[model samples]
Target: MKKFRYIVCLLSLATLSSCDSILDKGPLDAFTNDNFWTGEGNVSGYANTFYEQFLGYGNAGGSGDFYFNSLSDDQVGRDFDQYPNNKGVPSSSTTWRNGWIEVRRANIMIEKVSQMTTLDDAARNHWLGVARLMRAWQYYKLVRMYGNVQWVEKSLDITDEGVLYGARDDRDMVMDRVLDDLNFATQNVKDVASKTTWNRSMANAMKAEVCLYEGTFRKYRKSEDSQKAPDGAGATKFLTACKEACAAVMAKGYSLNTSYQGNYNSIDLSKNPEMILYKAYKEGLLMHSLIAYICSSTQISGMSKNAFESYLFTDGKPLALTALNKTDKAPMVDGHLSLKDILAVRDKRLSQTIDGVLLYNGRGYTRYNVGMESTASSGYGICKYDNPAIPEGFRNNTTKNYTHAPLFWLSVVYLNYAEACAELGAITNDDLNKSINLLKDRAGLPRITTAIGFSDPANNHGVSDLIWEIRRERRCELMFDNNVRYWDLVRWHQLDKLDNSKNPDILRGANVANDMSGCKADKVGEYIDGSKASIRAYDKKYYLYPIPSGQIALNPQLAPNNPGWE
Candidate 1:
């Protein structure tokens, strides 16, 4: 409870009559109505609090629940129930509740920073730009989730009777407000070189992301006879804007990480080239708790049953029915695959995401060291953030921790560019070539096509084919970046199109007898477990998570519960 108190403090919602003096200097200090607007650093620090909130929810809990496996082809956990369950989610509320709180804080910073005479025009403008940008980011998440929501431009006092009873805003009104904030941010924000932290680039990236989503969502939302198709003229304009925004950062010299493992496996800031706007975790933040909580007690993290069955074999079954194939000679199961043979050609990212090797002892993984359970039993303990240098005997329950998680990375920008080009019908060979080559070449994989079996830049594909390729790339490249998986399905409205089976059928029947041996009285058994078979089945209603029942009773205007929940 004390840990979550930091969130309240950052939002200025703490019971401020007491404990104010002790936490005043800390980042979690409550913003009293009286002394809230003081110095430039205080304003900036308050703005930083909003960023901290985003890091807390978007990447930490949201990513684990939705991004990692819920929307992926991995196993889905059985104990889960949410909206878009079996294709119908309610329209009453949204998944992101605190987004508005962050927006309000950013607006407060924007308003107060303008009056800080102690800071020069240049510094003040820069800080204001960041505040506006952060506010836009908050709105972006809102608009993406629930089309039209109430838009609030100014920061409201929670204690204000008017604020506590405010109603939801129209969707288009929110977009206009987001655009207005972004326009200000884009013009006043200094170039990437001038900024030190991820503040400015993220602001710029938010503009691109919002424009792309609005353009695409608008195109898709309208009726077929309503003068807008999926590839309409409005979509074209928005795609152009996305291209320009992403290009600006690329011009500023942001590039992909050369090695996939290094990008996620290690937590050092110097080596991380892909993260544009991420929250940096220090020792006390315990941002690591979110990661460690999902893994095994011996390792780290505990995966929910809904998240456990998201992965599948090419045949679309869970791991119980499918076996991990070592050779590429068998019949291609899921044809039109992203790569020629996915099992044999494991993506470079797989190593970074899973603990395929044992970590109990300080030694490399061997064939017989069956200490850790696979994705089925342990719910896919994502090892991407684990630091191998931590002493092997040190249990994750105590010493192990993750320092940071990127809220928005450069890879998404590339994806935005790819999607926009596909919508525009201007997806040239050069575009696909550059996009896929940049991603694949960096990861040491062969970019294969129908004409060229692998890495032949001469073989260029059509826009449709490249779109599928890009989606696959994004799935593999940006796994667990945020709550991207669930939202991706929502944006495309493809949640219903998904086949919700539980297990991987491919690895189930393969030569696994050698891989199933047990060690010393079943202490180190690699044998297949019965639980893996149970996770292979799918439930349609697991799409949008339930809006907490308590929230529904709080406001009658907020609409009813999602489809699957009673």
Candidate 2:
């Protein structure tokens, strides 16, 4: 379709009387396909739809029930009915879980933009890449959540029952299409932009994450009836893709922020180079519940002691090996072993990520002894995303503080590259400097070397001690972020570690509360015993979520839910 320049000439007295010809001019109120898509601004405006639809913000509203950082072993929420606990889930409803609705919107934009003859090749390709990037992101999230789903590429007729109620595509086939979309996006998207915008950096980051997830997810959880295109037990191919994608972004010169907490709790994102992509929030225009969540009395989702125990000793050795190894920390203000001692001897990230004290009305209230029982039951004060400046203020008053939430950062790219290479058995010391060492430096821990790894061995990962440490770095650095630790457990087939039946000690932590005066050492113990917390246990069936019962009813093609989900 060749676009012609549309020039509107206002009607005058002479032309007004000639109403027959005057009505032929373009209408001033609305745009038809002929008039729209004739300028860059319109096309760009259409592409902007993906941002608000697919992305989320700091303390944002619609991210219901998915504080991924909170629902796993590392962080525990008081609401025991959330995911992995296997309660409070929908029995059936395809409402939007598979993301077909979002895909339909993106495909319309892609198709409309492609048909615009007014757009130059560069403009068209760039816009297309943006659309594809979003499409790939949505599909990846869907597949991860629902296994395989109906793959739709274009807007469909509502009355067309066959297309609307069709059988689902295989997960591997859909993911291959997802990768193809990502590949196109990486090659064509813009390289420089605001942290909130999509670009090649985001594309590569998605590729690194998606490919590595697919690779590990396939290796750890595949069944006899799974997608067979990317066949075999090894995750080498996708891991290689993950490694190269991460390296490509690293080449763009993003580095770790010196202050571990610098990337978060900011009013703006202009200065954080480490955040390759983030959700920008402007106070009054687009603020969220981050402040509310941190300060609310209902803030039950607190960090777990497992997370605190995961941090390495200051000397880069595991606390498991240090003097702090299960040694009762200094008796609490209440005369029980508590977190106070660990804060002093552990890596610098401990205090930065968790809170030990709160300043209230110019007086300091300790997290352990103070009356914060309503906020956290296990005595772990989750202060990671708290407004760093407002310690005394809880449930922050609607103030002018802008909280920019991070989505993707360079450290993830580094970790992704390092782990993928490690999985391939091709990582080296130079690779460590390029990837893991950067995080070690940020955490003020010693760097890894062949000699260092052998001298001080890691407790997990048969691959190598270095690989285990790399995994540990990821666990600590990305802790409380939710998906990283939980997903890593899935891909590494380590969810069994969460099982109290097999690992009876999985749920133990310091159970401290009010009035420290009479508190004895015997008063402190595990928050939930093995008999009561049955939901924390994991089995092979938990590897993949069940295809919703509602979805199967809508189309029986989805029946015979994933392994144990039935």
lDDT of all the models against the reference? 0.50, 0.63
Q: Write the per-residue lDDT of candidate 2 for residues 366-484, one digit (tens) a residue.
A: 34333233344334556666654543443254343356777888988888988888777788889889898888888878888744544334354454676677777888787666366
TM-score of each: 0.69, 0.82
Candidate 1, residues 1-566, lDDT tens digits: the string is: 44234335645552232224434776664655556666665555555554444543223223432223443333233223223334334333434556666666676667777777788887788888888887788777766654445577676553543443345565556766777777778777765542236355776677888877766665554332122235456566666777777766666567777766555544555557776765555553543444333344442222322222223334322334444553422222222111234333355565455544322111112112222322322223456655545433321433344445556667778777777776666776666565655776655565534232222121122224445456556666766656565556555544433443422321121112222232111111332222333232334334334445444454434444433454
Where does model 1 exceed 4 Å of error?
A: 1-23, 26-36, 56-71, 78-97, 157-167, 192-198, 221-234, 282-287, 290-344, 355-375, 378-382, 393-395, 448-463, 498-566
Q: What is the lDDT of residue 460 in candidate 1?
A: 24
